[model samples]
Target: MEISVKDLTKKYKDKYALDHVSFSILEPKIYGLLGRNGAGKTTFMEILAGHILATSGEITINNENPFDNQHLIESICLIKEGNNFKRDLSIKNVLCIYSMFYPTWDPDLAEELVKIYGLDKKAKVKTLSKGMESALGIIVGLSSKAPITIFDEPYIGLDAAARRRFYEILLEEYEKEKRIIIFSTHLIDEVSLLFEEILIIQDGRLILREEADVLRHSTCAVTGSIQQVEAFSKDKKVLNKKELAGMMTAFVYCRKEEAVAEGLKAEGIPVQELMIHLTENKGA
Candidate 1:
């Protein structure tokens, strides 16, 4: 599905959760939806999945509005951090409900993941630990096989090993079948490798949207003597700067070739570093 958002805005009284955001997304690609807390990433995703109405502007999935559209809703899935299932329901019952809702639900895959995550089918959801709850959400998101699947912090309470398992399974599933996967996560460095494109939101506004490779190479850190670093930074968009004694490091948004030609050591900025520097408070 191709998703198009134009001037999308969501307001809560005098406050705006999303401020005139607009973007178009093509299907069968993994997108990293990155932002600080309260940056409207969830609001944007909820609007896209038709769970909430936009106060203004519009969104279309393959040229059709998704709001109250059951045909479109079934094709989209949004698995948030918690409250995905009723606490009193057994694991078996939850899966059965999901199977009924999503026509593409894979029973075999769900069963396999239940065993892998150590969730007994007869056990009530209320008795499961936090990590188990997260694991179940992951199972549903992956097994539903929805064309547009959004996972908002899907591995909240998981240990490192279990998180790695989720990542592995995510990659495995994507390799087998291509679909739109919008993943929101705080572990930028760990999960960045899976993203083909990245969207950055800051203060309820869309700040950056670029291919992962292009973004990594878009900015670089140059380190050298104060004079050399400052000289190299001239006329460039500097994202950050630090000085230690006579040495200086300037992270600038410019081509790698430009930084190297200016007689400074250039290092490609990692996604996590780029995000931090871009979103860091300027006044601080």
Candidate 2:
């Protein structure tokens, strides 16, 4: 399903959780919704999933407003930050209830995911560990087979090994089903390879949206002597820079060809590393 958000804004009295955010999501693509904590990713996802109303502006899925629209809501599934399941219900019962709600729910896939995540179907949700709860959320999010599926920090509290398993299964399912998947995660480097496109939000505003590989290739770090670095960075848009003794290093945003043609080597910097540096370094 194609999603269109036009001038979408969400406010909480004095704060704007989503500040006039607008973007369109083409179907059958995996999008990594990235931002620091309180960047409004969850707010945007909540509005998209129809769980909350936007303070202003609009959102449409297949040209229909999703807010309070059951037909549209049924096609969208969101696994948010907290546990929405009844604590007293067993894992199996929770899955059963979800199956009743979503017409496209795949029982086989849910069962397979439960086994894959090492979740005990008969165990009450209240008894499960944090990691197990996350696993359960992922299982339902993936197996629901909703056209527009959003996972907000779905792997929180999971160990490295379990997180890897979730990523693998997510990729496997996407390859077979070709559905839209929007994931909000702080673990960018670990899961970036799975995203076809990336949307970055900062301070409740959309910073940039582009193809993942293209976005990475569009920015690069150049290191050399202070003179050499400064000379090379003269005309480029530098995202960040640093100086150590007489040496200088700069991370700039420019076309790959232009950087190469300028005799500056452009290397692929991991998104997480780049974000950390960008967030910390303030040199213009």
| Cα lDDT, model 1, residue 208 | 88
TM-scores, one per candidate:
0.96, 0.94
lDDT of 1 at 232: 77
Top lDDT hit: 1
TM-score of 1: 0.96
Model 1, range 126-209, lDDT digits (tens) per residue?
999999999999999999999999999998899999999999999999999999999999999889999999999987889889
Q: What residue runs in model 2 are displaced by over 4 Å at the alpha carbon? A: 255-265, 277-284
Q: Pairs clashing in candidate 1?
A: none
Evaluate model 2: give its TM-score.
Answer: 0.94
Q: After superposition, how far is residue 199 of candidate 2 from its true place, in Å?
A: 0.7
**Lowest summed lDDT over 10 consecutive residues: which window, candidate 1?**
275-284
